[model samples]
Target chain A: MKGIRSVLYMHWRSVGSWVYIPWLILGSVFLINYGWRSFHQDSQSTNDVGNMVIFIYLFTVAWIFNGQLFAFASGLSIKRMHFVLGSVMAAILISIGSSLLLMLLIVVENMTNGWGIDWHTFSWKVTQTFAYWEQFAIYLLVFLCLILLGFFLSSIVIRFRKRGLLVFGVLLYVFFLVISNTSVNGFDHEEAFWTWIGQHGLLVFYSLIPAIILLLFGCYMLFMRRAIIRS
Target chain B: MHVKLSKVRKAYGKNVVLNDINMVLEKEKIYGLVGRNGAGKTTLLKIIAAQLFPSEGTVQVNEENPFENEAILSQLCFVKESQTYPDHFTVKDILLTAKATFPLWDETFCQALVARYNVPVKLRMRKLSRGMRSVVGVIIGLASRAPLTIFDEPYLGMDAVARQYFYDQLLADYADHPRTIILSTHLIDEVSELLEHVIVVKEGRILMQEDVETLRAGAVTVTGEKGKVAAFIQQQHVLSSQTLGNVTNVMIFGTISRQERLQAEAEGLSFSAVSLQKVMVHLTDQEKGSA
Candidate 1:
């Protein structure tokens, strides 16, 4: 427990400020959108893409932290399990904090009618039907999934270096290509997928719990087996 | 803590880093792991610290496998020559994290060392100079006071005075709080006096491991007439031999009794104690020659 705590504290001190970067970016983008909409006045469309910035930032943070802090912690004689536990705990804490803040912003956006510009940054029309707790759960789960995915990818790179990344990239390209071909051949599943997610709501995110666990497990195996700090 | 490596081997594909290395490191002694570049010094240290796994064989720290064992890892602190920190981390952040990680961390000692080194606590690590970064590593190794502390060329960019200060502080701290210390460095002569035992590595094998006093006492360079030097070196393990005109100098790897020395002196032969550095060089050079 103490070892895990140490790693958590190290993570906090090392890149804690990075958590706010997405907020700063989102704030800037919101200001721009609000100013544009205020001038237009006739534009009633809501901007739902603004919240994606935090997800992207969290993914990047996880990847960089896994690459950099893992080596540093290993140098400090930290156990691999301790590092995994500590990092996962830190990710959870960050998810909780960010989710609560986003929930607050959603409430404020609703009350002020998107700050008088009719813009929807934190509140999406699809999720507005769900309860506050369910919406928070959705955000938290999405954050964890992205963060864990980042950790898994970085672990692959750490274990197998550039070759692993190249292989993964090729596989991802193939996957997307197959999906695109399927859609072009009239086997369109995008609408069905979204409908399913919309029907399931929180359950859709809850199903990702297994994947989160698998990603964490993969990271542990890669790190424990052969993760050396390359010079 | 006692560290034992038996038949330890590390290889990356066909390139073997450490081969068949077997050693027992006892408690409260400083062992110098001296070797040339790519001689497997760092590989052996990493295996011992559990940062790396041996390709074959086993390593036991305090009679337990250290891999993923937090209890054992907590007792070990390995400060690498190329030790890295997060770019945004301040020196104070590093120290605080070290304190939290090591169970026997000494805050007062750490603070004093920081003051002595004059490292800026608030400055991010990437902003610090190379020498200052090395100083931070030195301070962490000294103040952590782990039961098994290993420093692999921990003073890469440090100045002469700072390096000397590190040696003094290490010795002083070791005297008060005894523990096992393994120092792997290229600067053998500078740290020879500080080392209690020396492990000479060559070509992925242990060339020799001996007590410093034993090596100093047993290895000697005898200078005398060519005929007498030849006779003296006969049936002895001669590490190296050189001849200039009628005088011959031969370094042998065996002790000379006082009677033998007196007899040799009366016969007009002079003996000089071989420095640890010289012994290391000769030993490695002999291995190269044999290879």
Candidate 2:
């Protein structure tokens, strides 16, 4: 119990020292919010603006938060499970809190000036909003996808030392090209992709299984492999 | 609580670092661990500290394996010369972390040593000079005061004044609260007066382990006429013999009896005790030349 607590304290102190980074992330989110409101205010497709805002928010957090979390875990003595749980908890709390405050502000603005943006369409694109279960399913899928992406990034980033960041960019571009060219699932068309996703939600669920397996396997190779212990 | 290493072997890839080493470290004594560079001194200390595992044999501390054993780890403090702490953290933060990690940490001693050394509390570790970094290691070792405290060449960068301060504080602290302190260093002469027992390692093996006074008493240098000194050194382990014309200086490893002393005096021989520094140099040099 004492060892566990000590590990927790150490992890908290280390991450807490990087509080400045999170604040910068939050500031970027606010800037995105203000920019979206102003730029789409006069557009004929103003209704589509909310959808874009949601996409930006989700993508930004997924990219920045996951990257910083991986770096934090690499440099600490804490266990991987503890780090994963702590980061998830902290991200959920901060994202939800910020979203709620922003939601309230949006509501007040709509009530006063009658702004009309399609919440259903925005939510549908960022997160499936057909049913609670379907929404949760889509969220899980996105999480697995991003985590696998993060795992791959972390593996290469940490393994290559100084030139890791540059190498990762090139590798990601190559990976993107490979997936685009292969089209192994015969869903090169958007209609086919969505139709397949809609008909066989189970298939979507099954796709996540492999992504999760790959993610965990990559994590083990990067962080827990005995050979990673440097003399 | 006693520690023992029996037939412990450690190898780095194709090169052997520690070969058939054996030693017993009793509790409540100040042990001086001495050896030259690449003599497996740090490797041996790391093995005992549980920072590195031996490739063969066993190292038992208080009848328990020290590696990953929190029960034993809590009682051990291994401070190295280049002990690392986070760069952004201040000295106070490092002290706090140490206090949190070591269950038996002494706050009073920590504060006293910080005050004695006049370390800057607010300064970040990266900004501190080399001597200050050594001071930090010294403070941690003293403040931890774990049942087993091992310091591996921690005073290398410290000046003479700071080194003296550390030695004085260490002795005073140990007198008031006794603990097993193992110090691995090349500065044998400076610390010979403070050590209770001396363990000399040569070529990855235990060359000699004996009480400091016993080791000092066991050797003497006899200088006289070349022929008489050469005859007198017969049947004795001669560490080294140098001849300049008729005068010869011979260092023999073994005590001179009263009769032997009388006989040497009658032959107009001058005798003196061998300094610990000279003995260590000769011992290491001989091992190297033999290899």
Candidate 3:
């Protein structure tokens, strides 16, 4: 447990600056949206996808931190299991923090009527009917899922280098291509799949718990167990 | 701590880096791991440090497997020549992390070393010069005070004075706090005196492991008239021999008794001490010739 704490502390010390970049970007986007909405006097609620920026940034943070910190932790004689556990715990803490912040922002947005410009940045039009706690849970689960996916992908790259990323990219492209081709009655199958997810809402987010576990497991067993620092 | 490797072999794909490596490293001794580049010195050290796994066989640290064992890892520190730090990490950050990671970290000694080396604690690691980076590694290795500390060419771009100071500091600290230290370096002569035992590695295998005194006592260079030198070392294992005009110098590998030396000197064959560096060169050269 002490080893895990050390790893956690090291990670925070080294990459703590990265934690704020997403917020900075989100804040900038919010300002721009607010300015545009105020200037245009748009009363209709806008379904801005700007909030998705945080998720993308979180993914990037996870990918970079996993790749770099794994080598650094190994240099410190940290056990692989401890490093993995520390990373997971860090991700959980970040997710919880982000979820709470998003929840507060959503409450503020609702109370102020979308910052008085009818722009939905925190509370999307699709999920405004859900309770605040449920939204927080969804955000937490989504953050964890994306972060773990990033970790799993980064582990693949660390273990096999560029070739692994190339292979994974090709596989992902093929998967999307197959999904796009499997259309039914003129409706795009990929869009239909997302529509199903949108309809399920909380159920879809809740299902990510198993996926997060699987990604964490794959990261450890497939790449991290015998990983070595390669210059 | 006692470290034992039995039949340890490490291979990358079909390219074998280390093979049939079996050795015991006793506690509280400074052992020099001298070998040429690509001679598997780093691989062997990594195996012992638990940063890597051998393809076959076992490595026992204090009679326990060290892989993922926190109890063993906390007592070991391995400093590499090309040690990498996070790009944003300052020297102070690294020192703090090392202090937290190593159980026996000496912050006072670390600060003293930092002051002695004049390291810029606020500078990012990437902003530091090569020598400065090396100094950081040296400070961590020395201040960690680990039971089994291994330095694989920790002084890469350090100046001569700094290197000498590092040697002095290492020796002084070892005297004060006895622990096993393994120094792998190409500058054999510079560290020869600091080493208590020398482990000469050649082509992924240990050629010889002997005490410093025993190695020095066993090898000698006989210099005299060509015919006299040739006659004097007739039964000895000659590592190498050179002739210029009527003079000859032959490096003999086996021991020479006091009576034999006196007799040889009386016969006008003079002897000179062989530097550890020369011995290592000739030894590796001999291995290459045979191979």
What is the C-alpha DockQ of each candidate?
Answer: 0.80, 0.17, 0.66
Model 1, residue pairs in steric clash: none
Cα deviation in Å at residue B130, candidate 3? 0.9
How large is the interface RMSD of each prediction? 1.0, 6.3, 1.2
User: Model 2 clash pairs?
Assistant: none
Fnat, 2 decimals, each candidate: 0.85, 0.05, 0.55
Report how far off residue B27 is in candidate 3 (Å): 1.1
Stretches of candidate 1 exceeding 4 Å from the true structure:
A174-202, A208-226, B286-291
> Between the candidate structures 1 and 2, which one is better when assessed by lDDT?
1
Across B151-234, the per-residue lDDT of candidate 1 in tens digits comes to 999998899999999999999999999999999988888998899999988889998899988998998999999999898778
lDDT of each: 0.86, 0.67, 0.86
The TM-score of chain B in candidate 1 is 0.97
Candidate 1 C-alpha lDDT tens digits along A23-69: 88878887887787788876665657688888898888888888788
Candidate 3 per-residue C-alpha lDDT over B1-291 given as tens digits, one digit per residue, 9 for 90 to 100: 899999999998999999999999999999999978888999999999888889999999999999989899888888998678877788988899889888899999999999999999999999999999999999999999999999999999999999999999999999999999999999999998899999988889998999999988888999999998988888987888899999998888887889999999998998888988888887877453242
* lDDT score, candidate 1: 0.86
Q: How many residue pairs clash per model?
A: 0, 0, 0
Tell me the lDDT of model 1 at B30: 96
